[model samples]
Target: MSKERSSRILHGFISACLVAAVAAFIILAIPDHLGRAGIGAGSATKKNFPSAKNLSSIVDLEKEKQAAEVKIENPSGQLAYFKPEQVPIPPGQDAQAQDLTLTDPNQSPDVAGGSGAAVDDSSFGNAVPIEPEPTETFQGVPDNFVPVAEDTPRGSSITLVTYPRSSLAIHEPPAHVLRRSKKEYSWIFTPPELEKDVAFWKAIYSRYDKNQVVLHHPIYLDIIYDVVDLGYIEGDMRLSELEKQHKKEKLIEEKRERIVSILEMLAQNQRLSSSLNDEEWRIKKLFDNVGDPKKFQRAAEEFGVRAQIGQRDKFIAGLKYSGRYLGEIERIYEESGMPRELSRLIFVESMFNLKAKSSVGASGIWQFMPQTGKLYLRMNKIVDERNDPIAATHASIKLLRHNYNELGTWPLAINAYNAGRGRLKQAVQTLGTKDIAKIVKNFKHRAYGFASRNFFPEYLAALEVAENPEKYFGPISYDDPLRFEMVRTAYHISLPSVAGVSGIPLEELLELNPGFSSKVISGDQLIPIAYPIKVPEGKGSIFIAAAARAPKSQRGSIRHVVAPNETVNSIAWMYGIDPTRIRQANANIRRNPSKGEIIVIPFD
Candidate 1:
């Protein structure tokens, strides 16, 4: 056959097959579809209504009854598809009634003129009432449950507002770690971030052991408590009668026994001694009785054998101040999705000291380094937001959330806060695990040191001690939180001038706004435009009005020659300003302004 004839034959064959397939589909589907609509083959329709004349003879009552029974048998059928005129909609029902909306509005006497098969309106009520089932209860998908990256549009830019140069003139110093601590904690601050290969879990675990209470030198001091001896064993320090009252726990029982034994020895020694003073006799007898006094003293000096009484006393004092700001701290941590107990980290960091600063440049209660502090806080010559408890808490919250997001666990995230997230990430990826205990035990890196490994454990210890301060120490009195209102500055005004206008003491105003750098207060730099100066509550209006009435000359920057007894803090306090700003103004003065030094004080 020719090629053209072959193609035509193939096309005809394909067309015939298509027609057969379509005809077969219609044959199979027609019955099911028509049956659902109440119109199917072999299903004869019954007359539902009687004719006006000879109603009984016009309708077949038996046939209608059979049709109704069929509908009842197939409850799933679409009875709604039937027209009221074509099928009997039991009497007293509307022609447009839905399958579910059935009602009997009238009681007709069994269609009096119709045949005995007349539909009864009340019969429809026997059918079960169908209520639309509640849409499958929708529990929304969680944020992390799905792949968000696939759904989020790429390359979206978000705007962030920092301090406005136009509204507030700010002079930020070069970013560097500013250490302002009184004591150096050689152990706590020397550790590096956790490493995958470092195995320091044993050391880290020691801090978390509830039964083992370890004491070390504080970052703020270099002293250790004196050692004492009991009948059975020696203790680092003697506990007072009040201290004994709180030492009832089983874990503390052993330590308490040792302490009680030492007290008994001290009492016996005191009774026997005739030459020495009470203090001298106690010391001499303790040294004479408990091994060698010189040996114990040297050991304490070298190893921080016991927690210093002065330091602990200072901590107890710090708790008093913590009461003032704990609420705000908890609120910040909670809002940031961090555990509220983490606020106790501040106690470990700075003993809740707002003015605390480390030699390495970490500052404030959160101990943020200058570089990190600048990320969330305004760290400048005129203002360091880290000094503001509320501001620093906010910054700390943001940093902690970022840490948690990156590390996926609180311990690792908290450790990242001290050691840096990049190192933790590298350690986690290298080790293929984020378990803090495992990482601490096995992780090894050049940068991972004692401090980084111990950070989380130290936080846990701090949290434990802080939660039960009354247990560790005696009853404590908390400082009330500082309350103040922020008042905006229209122009550069002197800190002293602010005090004068607000009718508040210069010391009080300066205490209220520790965030202001001394330069802004001392007339070296103007209190930047629109800078909010905090004043005692209810003093905002009076201060603003007073500031306006104050002479322009008083509000401008001034040159002051430091005099005798004029330290930076004292000078700053004199002017209602930040001492840091003053130190910034005079680069030569590293910490305090020396006597006879020339310093410029900025008016705000």
Candidate 2:
């Protein structure tokens, strides 16, 4: 066979296939063409399927495509077929549904089927559901948002939070309270205007990348009143005590913020001596640093910061104590090859009264609180080394050493000792400079806490008076460092019991056991077995031996609780009694009880 002849034969076959496909489709869809024009060929009547020629002439494909689908369920029955065409979209709606779709609704008699089947009477158990459009009039939005044309996509449902951006600022209030009373008329007062303006003002301030003033539009003066807080003045702030100093501090803060505000207002109003950016930068830097920029500006404009804080003997005393401690500390000063007199800091802190307790619960000559003392010193039911000068001094030294290791500066270390290290570090970081005065004025940061703010100045002042005590106090007596003998008990014991046995005063015994409390020392717990036992200079060994026995009168051993800053020997001698007798009475009196308590005092 020739190749050209074979190619022609293939083309003829393709043409024949296309023509047959068209004819077959027309023959199948004849019934659907008849039904939509108010006629049905594939109706219940059997004759509807044959010769449905009138339906084929009026068919419109585009209109049929635009119509929505319809579902028709048929129960078990004889096969039926129907054909319809040109189904239009329903009135006031885009489309309608048809029950069924068939490739050929009206077909030749050999094919038995109905294109759009009707639901049977027995098949009524199943139902189809249709959804309706939602109803909500969303106000404040562009109104022409409905879907009108066919095939248009639906838009998203509107919601409250998803509303426009410009509506954010006034959407809700921070807080509100409502009250109803039978005794009075209904009344409503809005929140004071002050906080709103301040927050808004801060928002304005935040707009600048490295400067301020982006937009400026003021409401009434009343709105400005909302931003200002004069209540901080306390209205009737007292001028006595430290009140004057406090008022000055508060005023300084106000003036500082005002300075920033003024510079911003001036630059924005075009009333400045330099570029707006320059003024802004200066104001912001001043805001970030210590001292009131406003005050500094005023001072620069007027005179200068020439005021002095007048000399105070108390301040001198504190500095002197600091110097004294610098010369005599045990672990940090002596052991670390540092100055020994540094031990005098403890004296400045608690006036060398081992039993002194501060308002904050700080105790001992070192003024270590209960928890802090517990950490470094052995403090138990029978022993608290914080009262003992040698023991507490060692603990203080160790504590200072730890602080120094963490913070290189001795001044900062001292600050950390009084104020916790965390607060000191926070203040240092906030001020960008480790200036003590700056830390004092930071009301927001914990660095401004009463104790922490005062700690540095108080410590420095302690050093001053310690150097020359006689200058402040007339010829202050020199009390020698106390001494004691090491006495070991074979069993559990109380000071009063020991006093009764030895005919020694309980107060005397208590003075020796300065580190103990509860008078009852258990045999098991860690306690000074050979604790420093003080006795009269001429007392014999027989007296000490006799006091070692436990007795009832001595069981509830008592010691004169020497008031703060009182001397143990002085109290003992005051009662015309031996000091050893008191020590024996209260075996557990750790540190001398400065606030005098009943003690086993000997007769004169």
Candidate 3:
């Protein structure tokens, strides 16, 4: 063959070879492309499969599809389909789990074929095992899984599932530890030896009303002869006050006479048991411990019947009012290292009455007489700290501490608060015993009356009632604690001026600072310099600032000499002030001021 013909044959053969190679490449690539498109049935190669990132997204999509197919079996054993979002997240999972679309990988279409043929997952390695769904029923979901309301929309109603309460763990904050007291006063205050007397006083304070009078022996308080109902006497408004008083005295005297008669009859007749009345039998039962035949006579003569006025209403009132100052009083006693229970003695003395005053010059809630009060309290024409609850509390603490120091026992010290300290000391010396129970039983002095003898027991009873008021008087709505800030006067200032400066009502200032006398409250006199006065809470600094800004001339009393014919109205008109202001400034002044007498005109 020629060289050109040979070359042409070689080129045709080369073209045929290239065409055959391209056909083989097309045949190989078509299978891979079809396999990747999931069209033909063949195991997908590692390269044909998705990348790691794409594989994650595919798994998530498969999971969401499988989750939609999964059904939760409630307590009724009925399969219920819930949205993946509606499913409660398991306890160990975070809040992000609420948004997660969960599914069973074993049921995923990617891992298992929809035609029920298992796909080989050896390339992806072993699959993660799914946890079993929780089957616990919740509070609102019933065991039978009935719909809550007939009107509830079908398939729209959701039944909440929760873990059993027993399986739930609750975490509480640790409790704060408090300081324990070193000493206890229970035995000293509520001694078993004096329980009978204390109980008697407790009955008087709680069980009986103001109209009831308990008649009992002076020494043996448990020996209650009778309880006289004086309610009838009180209800008789038609009777004059004098007539009512006389009628009550007569009734009490008649009862006394009858009791004496019974005792005398019992003493004279040994065979009186057959005809004895119900009251006589009760009285006879009380004397069963006595061995002497003439005991009735001795009792009639020595065991004089004493009457105690019931204080239940007063006690209840005291309890309600006590809330205002109880916290502060307790704090004061605690700070002084004294028995805080002693502060309840005010309930016994004056029933927490701030305006309490005794006929014998005793005053305030503490009942401090003039002689005793003068030592620790400030009492003068311009101010009386005795009427001030806070100031009086301090004074009472000092006096009580002093008494305790001198008397060496709380019983004697408390008694000294009512009776004179000298008298209690004398009784201790005479009795030759410091035991209050023994002193109460045997020691008898003419001066140491029923009140002095029963003082300690009354205190114990008051303490018990005050501590547990709900037991005596059911549920009390107490006054809120007094809120104020104490400030000392920088200068002698009138109350009206203080009110003007601090922007507090004049009446409120007067109420808070009860230590200020009428003269001080009015413009007749000025609040003394350095004297502590109570202002509304958070107003102390404001008062100080305002007082500093006030002119010196307007701060103190503005006095005027009365002309010969000057009346209160005329003097008020002359000063261009109110007549009422003049009267308030000069409380002692009546309709007219005496000639040449000094009168005060209130200045704003």
lDDT of each: 0.49, 0.39, 0.60
- Between candidates 2 and 3, the one scoring higher on TM-score is 3
Candidate 1 minimal-lDDT segment of 10 residues: 120-129
Better of 1 and 2 by lDDT: 1
Given candidate 3, what's the lDDT at residue 600? Answer: 59
Better of 1 and 3 by TM-score: 3
| Residue-by-residue lDDT tens digits, candidate 3, 1-604 | 6999999999999999999999998878887777666566655532343322111122332343344333655442323333323332322345564333222111111110111111111011111112212321111211222111221212211221111110001111111112334244433456677889999999999999888878776767788888889889988989998998888888887887777777777777765686898988888787776687777887788765677878999998887787777666665566567766678789988998988989997877888776666556555444566777666777778778888898888888888888778888888899887787777666778888888888888998987777667778877767666665444433445666646534567787777766666666665555533334566654444444333333321233356655454566544433223467668777778775676677655443
Question: Can you give the TM-score per candidate against the true fold?
Answer: 0.44, 0.37, 0.57
- Give the per-residue lDDT of model 1 (tens digit) for 1-604: 6999999999999999999999998987776677666577554432233222222223333443333222211222112111112222333345664232212111111111111221111001001112212331112322222111122111111111111121001112211112323232122221243321122222222222222343322221112123222212223247654554355233344543444443445545544567655644544444443354344334334323332122354466667777666765565455455556567678768887888999998888888887777456554445676787767777777787899887877777788988899989988998999877667657888698657766776665565456555556656666655455444543445566546433567777878777777765564444533344666654444454444433331233455655554455544533444566666666677444455556775442
Each candidate's clash count:
38, 103, 0
Give the alpha carbon lDDT tens digit for every residue of 197-251 in model 2: 3334223222122111122212211122112222334454555537844765565
Candidate closest to the true structure, highest TM-score:
3
Candidate topping lDDT: 3
After superposing candidate 3, which stretches have Cα over 4 Å from the reference? 1-183, 236-250, 290-295, 485-491, 494-507, 521-524, 535-604
Error of 2 at 274 (Å): 36
